[model samples]
Target: MSVSFHLCQPGGGASCGACCGLYNFRDHSRAALTRRLTAQTERLSRAPHTPEAYGEAARELTANRDAPALFPIVRVCPLLGFLDAEHQRVGCLGHPRVTGGVDLRDCGVYRATVCESFTCPSFGWLTDAQARLVQAACADWYLYGLVITDVEFVRGCLKLLEWELGGPASPDVLRERPDSLAAVRRLFALKETAPGRDGQATVFGRFAHDTEGEPTPRSLDYAALGTRAAPEDDVVLCLGYTPPDAPALLAARALVRDHVRAVAATFPA
Candidate 1:
């Protein structure tokens, strides 16, 4: 089964991105390389880890330099496929609502079996189950608009997880909220309460082919997703923000249930 070009759903297949030259994004990586080449003199760059200090850089972007990527430092090297040359309005093509016009295999990894193969070391789930849940939740959060709400340092975990999963590692996912990542973590982990069909819902946060100006946006055929249903106990790992150890795993599970109740309270359709 092919993955959705809009939301990167769980399936088995490769995208054109893996074959960049054969695909349209051949120059996408080159453009970013050029930008970084002229951007370095790393010996002179300043590091700001504190929130107040971070605000200083944010001020510079909005008031002085007019730069995009407004946040503290990001460790992810190649932040690619941005909305503009400067990347001010970053977009995630993985969203079905956004990339409804794309074509099949137009993207690279999102449309491939990379999900089953991609694993982030930062996730360091103490147990296989925790790791699996985190993986599952991330996909759900990206594919579905499910939101996870909680107070734990989960958002931090999500950032670390995303980093390991080869995402931009940009703090943008946190959205100013300290626990934002954690919310995503929890939302993705609630697979137990998920109905039969919702499990295979396409996650758009992974692919954004439409935003890349493809002639016609494409998404995985949702009608056929049921045909690709995962087996009974072979958890797809793209579930949620998981803990590193056993105790933490239990805590993460409880948090997910609590969060599900809150979300259901607001929208019960």
Candidate 2:
């Protein structure tokens, strides 16, 4: 149910100049993306009665045609568009705006689970860590929980992943088999989401092993999620089939790891 718009800028050289490369810093914007997101999110300070309220606040930022920092001309990135005005988050950006655009139900971004689940590896404001990824591995668990609210979060995600990978999630399957819940909890503890030069995890996401040895991930468009991460990635097989091409979606499914060491491919160093 997700529709994606992608374009690659030629100037994005092999070094990923403004390409929005996933898991890598394609380029940095002079603007403070995090602050923008916080300001937008505060729209719910009064507590919106419906999703429409959320969508409207997000689009206010999107309407910016001039500020490239707000809407960068990325070569490769899913530009999440606001759905029709219904969820109650649309068209209330402190000015007169157009209404009757799209519905919150059909939003191009969060319509698919993949887009909602993915997070960017943001190494924001953390100075303690030499590399942002160091903070990333730490804060991932907390952010992971926020994305999915199921009680057995990781277990459910993996089970769904197993089924999507052309495998079934049997009830008798081990609950804490892949990574002990304890271990995962420990990892979250190490995560520091405080404000710093070298920040915590930048992104959150799911990936699929493509025909090539690449991990294809969905668009982690936090902008649509009502948050913002100054973006950029390739392909990976995820249980959530939401490629722009619905027909090819089934194809992304065909490469499921049947006799594969499932977890090995997912958890990378």
Candidate 3:
């Protein structure tokens, strides 16, 4: 189930800390996460590189964590922070590569071995091309992690595009053509741009926590909305749409349709 390429920190302006529980917080918006990571980076940069100092800093950061995890069961690491002075990348600050030959990830939420070995579902679910396209489309750490970690959102968008084109919407092709890649980027940008999905921090794209605190895939209540299911519904749900009624559902579908069509339009006529 291993992918041919690395999805985490694949370069070309892409990096991810999602496996470290980057997006587990309730307010995982770009602004909130930037503040959190910025604070962590600044604080850790001043601490001694010893395990004792790093562990204490980790505890203090967790104790003063800005927001509670949306999923209580998930572990959010305090060691995740911006890897660059410009704050364009996010990664494990405790990694030996960042800490100048000292591995301090053991001081974070998980052991160093676990952090080194763990691979998210994306490693298996996403092909090299798909992963590369996501990397290319989302250059910023915040948006890159948001879209790359969600395999369903990436796959759902591409599948819908294939349907719209009445043919294959190859990820490799999209990656090569600037115009097509730009269009595809707009489609993937729906992860952040889709409107009216606020106030539902509990809802992570198509999945929401049940009473037991486990994620469960949400479904469109067609019977309640009086509208039948559509192809775009999967992407719509992955976009975190909880449409209240038929009109709302249709609007969400239309939003997805426009983006999908835009990508398809870039194909040869």
| Strongest candidate by lDDT | 3
lDDT of 1 by residue, 1-269 (tens): 21112222221211111111111221223344234322321211232333343334333322432132211221111111222233222232222232353322213224324323443332232233332333334533222222111112234344344433445333343333335445544545443333222222222112222333333312333234333321211122223222234444344444544553432333212
Model 1 Cα displacement at 156 (Å)?
Answer: 21
Predicted structure 1: clash tally: 38
Top candidate (TM-score): 3
**Candidate 1, overall lDDT?**
0.29
The alpha-carbon lDDT assigned to residue 184 of candidate 3 equals 85
Winner on lDDT (1 vs 2): 1
TM-score of each: 0.23, 0.24, 0.97
After superposition on all C-alphas, the RMSD of every candidate to the true structure, in Å, is: 19.8, 18.3, 1.1
Off by over 4 Å in 1: 1-81, 85-245
Question: Model 1 misses residue 145 by how many Å?
Answer: 12
lDDT of 3 at 31: 86
Stronger candidate by TM-score (1 vs 2): 2
Q: Model 1 Cα RMSD, Å?
A: 19.8
If both were scored by lDDT, which would come out higher, candidate 1 or candidate 3?
3
Q: Please, what are the lDDT tens digits per residue for candidate 2 over residues 40-65?
A: 43543333433566455445534642
